[model samples]
Target chain A: MSDVRLSNGSPTLERTDPRLPEHPKPSACKSLFGPVDHEELKKDFNAHLRELEEAAAARWDFDFANDQPLANGRLQWELVEHSSVPDFYSRPPRENGVCSGNNNVDHNGNHHCDGMAQSEETSRADSQMECTEQSSGPRKRSACHDPSAQSKRSHTSPEEVSCPNLSHSAEHTPRKTRRLSALQCVQ
Target chain B: MEDQLLCCEVDSIRRAYQDVNLLNDRVLHTMLKAEENYLPSPNYFKCVQREIVPKMRKILATWMLEVCEEQKCEEEVFPLAMNYLDRFLSVEATRKTRLQLLGATCMFLASKMKETVPLTAEKLCIYTDNSVQPGELLQMELLVLNKLKWDLASVTPHDFIEHFLSKLKICPSTKQILRKHAQTFVALCATDVNFIASPPSMVAAGSVVAAVQGLYLKSQDVSLSSQNLTNFLSQVIRSDPDCLRSCQEQIESLLESSLRQAQQHGGPAESKRVDEEVDLSCTPTDVRDINI
Candidate 1:
């Protein structure tokens, strides 16, 4: 913005700095809504997310917050081998976490709140156990089970009917390749 | 020296060339079809919001515009962020206290959508003066993305500006200046609640017509006159010419009021602006002072 200020009457040569200052304009920096109640805001957010999750679970018959595949879901989820599908489905999240990286990256390599991730991590583990009991009589867990595979369900599913790419990318690669072939298991 | 040269080559402006392919009828038709899906409820202030009001929206929009201008974000970011804000508010009746956080989250998402080097969460938090944490912003971002159903590619008025300008027979430089003025009008409209839920194509047409009238470019082309341009663009967007005329008039009055406010606050310097804008038209090229 300073490069072409000819009307200002300054004749000094300008530096070619392309970047803006690290800090934003001070005029717009002050908070507009006064102090935020972090505790209260957190509560509201959790409740909203829970509602979204429950609606999604009912509509799609899958519990995304818990990563459990519902039996009555219209389209069943069967664990597939990592090599069977694209590497993007099973790839570990980048070290920076997500593509641009903030703190939104979760176990499934998608952006979610820390609270959601915490609850999702615990519940998903429990759901995996529940699925284990149902899918395979008593199969032992394997090392290759890729965990970056949790996808959103229907209704309130973060996955939209309009966006097939997102849902496609949500398919997790099965770690127990030996058992996946024997049984169309839910991971 | 060769290695340094290679590094410098990569550091140039990180935007892609304007895709001429995007300025075609097919794309314009697609945008016309797609734009309605992204509009906020026109009466969201009455139905959806209890704590937030129109006046508060204006304040937040002004601040967001300031930040975008200072940070040199792309023209689309501010309006896109505003779209996100309105969409979220349309669905969720939020408290007045969390409005800034919502505004910041919208900006974060919009910047990521449009900018090559998106605004960082840390810097955005700093702009909030620590009222909201980076983590909170990140969380809010998730909520917003989910609320929006990750439909971030909302057709903005800027999207229609190119197509409208393409159909115009003006010279390239003339089109460029007219585009700037129209974009400023679109940004101004984004701040005002009246233009909400109006089709982006209509807003773009209105802005183009209003800008052409402001620039006094009717002498260059018959199509540039207020009536002819309104008819032409209204047809292009397939709306009633009268509706387009009304939208243009609303924009003109908005510009006039904004200039009047500037004059009241700007003292001697603004008096000069008033003199230039004597016939109720805002300055065409000066974008910095056109705060709404």
Candidate 2:
């Protein structure tokens, strides 16, 4: 596990890093409600929602504040973004990074950064604006100097890398259509 | 004109099915592997060593299910919520009193992830009879998210159902029925802690197989041979035959006992009695002791 921390510490983790599979997007597909009478259901659902909203509003009047301290000492509502944390839990050493290193050696020889380069190209195309800034000058020189460091840089930019795979799969019409059919069948 | 449109729709569905078949295998594999880290320790409730028990979890899961059903929330919401609850209990030594609060908070988080219109924090508090405040639920939500390292996309058995069903060569009519029954089995699996031992894909395959068998037993023309089912499931899930069979057996046994219980005590009324019986002995405690 400590080894995972060391490996993920590298700056080059790309979208295609097999270790870090993209977050499973919440499936948009709806459940099969069976032979539900829509008119009856809509009426019931509306009444239920209205009742719930009323009850909730009543609770909100007196119980608005959480007992837990929000942000140090002050009581303020806040949204914390967790995108900065590279997903370290999922990356077992055998599946990605170090293992890919051996594959790099076996497939592309000493230019081990070849696999990283391919993924980086995809990432570059995927996030052109971000890649343009990061892929130029010092970073590229440093990447050339050390293959391991290059892998690190590629692995670290998960947002740039992971987003494309999700969008790519969704944009791919066949998968999208099948998801639609599956959703329809469920209904 | 109708026939041409039908043919085009079938062609599109078939093409999409093929694409998903390829993608589902890779995705399921990655998810199963990643889930190992997120699973709460099996003895998490035991380790907490208070009023918490395995039965309490069952009761809480039932309540969570009812809440989801009442809201018409997505099928994934309840199971995903259970995952959060178990993961939280594993790490935190929670008081028995806060179990429902934990369950509600988990549901709140999961509905946000899986539903089009999530259950509001205020609404979840109302479900708890106003014992908990919205702010507290929100606080617990953040605590759980942080504890889980913001990995809310943990795979549930539902993710694998469509993939497995597509692999089977069944008639279109029965496919809908089979999918529905399979979903019920998945929900059943979520209520029991034992199912956690099996990977989500295996549970899904098992549920589909069991649903087919259950449906077939009622009438005989389904054409679903065990050998064919086993071969297809093994290939698609990339699992050993023995593991799949064991999981199938577990699900079958769970179904049998549940069926027997329902028959003996007349269903929902009895389950409600059991829940009331369990709740009778509880003493309320401050939420601070929840130890998130």
Candidate 3:
């Protein structure tokens, strides 16, 4: 086992096998890249070698299992934790008026608040129409056409914008026949 | 004293072999995801309308190989550097003038990852004949790190060599020879772009099969026939035999062509002249335009 030699004679591996071949002198192939100042390269290489030695020595004292710096004051390992969502998602929503209540954020921070608000408004209209049948549909239809409806639409636009059938029910039902006709129309 | 040292070495090797399962799990988890993270687009250089053709890449790889050989870098460094180069090229439309600088920077980064003693920025800059500054190399290093998403733990064919080799029932001497040949084959694969599509494990298995077959051919040994070696490698690497066979064939063809080219070049001196001529022809005009 001791007599075995690797062809290139890697230093670290050679340390384990004393019988490995002697390190070849730096060869002329070094010139292949270009005219390198050998003295400067040797200096740089030696500095790098010392740094590696220090790092290796530090590694021996470092505690990998606990991932903590040991008494030697060396970093054992660096752990990088990646977030599934982008940075913006992890941040608190902006306090601006445009996206005030829209907290349902996708990974990219696109708000789902508009959809939520629409659904809530539609349910509100449904209950309102159930309470006062005759006046609600006509008022809602008028609201859809009214310029002021834009502001009110945030709260009531589901009936005005989405449910056009409510308008038809209001026109068809007589005041006395409102409840029965409304139910029939809904069915 | 020698016997005692040998005993300790054997014990360490045994312990390492015992921990292979843990090592494999960690390597698979990190490397597979890292592979997914930074794949080079197949035709990005062309899509970007860049002047970097396959011929230029081949020349660059050859130069990188020379640097690694001269420096006596680990087997993993050159391939890993090439991975960085390809991934960076896929994402960034690099100027032709900066290609060698990019190569040097990739080598620097890969050495940091794989070698005990990494090549310093100063040395790398010197390798470029001061055409690139150390500051510039450091900047490019950061750019590469960002583009790779800071995931440097790549799984090259070298990673799978030991696992594949351990499964073979050959004698110790034959195993060592096979490992050397397999290493050479892996380095050869890194120099060509065609092998880029193959997964690292497939490349490893293929190279081992090719190495064994190569050795067997030289010796005219019936035991090293393609069929037996293919079955053995596929079983060891836990890949489909068909895929492994195809990859092995590709490697064999690569080896043949490279050998033919080496012969055609006549010798190293002539080939060096050809490389220098290519470098001189490409750099001056490109560098001037980039500067302006």
Instruction: Name the top lDDT candidate.
Output: 1
Q: Candidate 2 deviates by what RMSD?
A: 21.1
lDDT of 2 by residue, B1-292 (tens): 7777666544321111124434455766776677666566777766764667888888778767766655656667777898888888877776666677678889987877754345776566666666565545554554565457556777777767766766666666667667766777787888888975567778888988777766652244443666567657866777887778788888888877666565565566564533322221111111112211
How far in Å is the alpha carbon of B47 misplaced in model 2? Answer: 3.8
Order of the predicted models by TM-score, top scorer first: 1, 3, 2
Any runs in candidate 1 off by more than 4 Å, and if so which?
A1-21, A59-85, A97-163, A166-187, B1-10, B267-292
User: Candidate 3 DockQ category?
Assistant: incorrect
Model 3 misplaced stretches (Cα beyond 4 Å): A1-187, B1-38, B217-224, B235-239, B271-292
Residue-wise C-alpha lDDT for candidate 3, range A1-187, written one tens digit per residue: 3433222222222122222123322332232223334355445434533443344334333222221223433111121111422233123333432211222422111123554443344344345444433322322121011111113223223333232234442332221112112121110
- The estimated TM-scores of all candidates read 0.76, 0.53, 0.53
Compose the digit string of candidate 3's lDDT tens values, residues B110-219. 87776534666766665665666665566456456655655676777777776666666677666766776677788888888887556777788898888776665424
Model 3 lDDT at residue A5:
27
**Residue-wise lDDT of candidate 1 within B1-292, one digit each (tens)?**
7776566645544333456776789988898999989989999999999999999998788777767766767778888999999999999899998999999889988887765567778777777877998777877886887778767888899888888988999987777777878887898899889988898888999999988887778877786778888888998999999999999999989988877776675677444323323322454635324421
True contacts kept of 1: 0.31
Residue pairs clashing in model 3 are: none
Fraction of real interface contacts that model 3 preserves: 0.00
CAPRI grade of model 2: incorrect
Ranked candidates, highest DockQ first: 1, 2, 3
Model 2 ranges off by over 4 Å: A1-187, B1-24, B48-50, B217-223, B267-292
As for lDDT, the candidate ahead, 2 or 3, is: 3
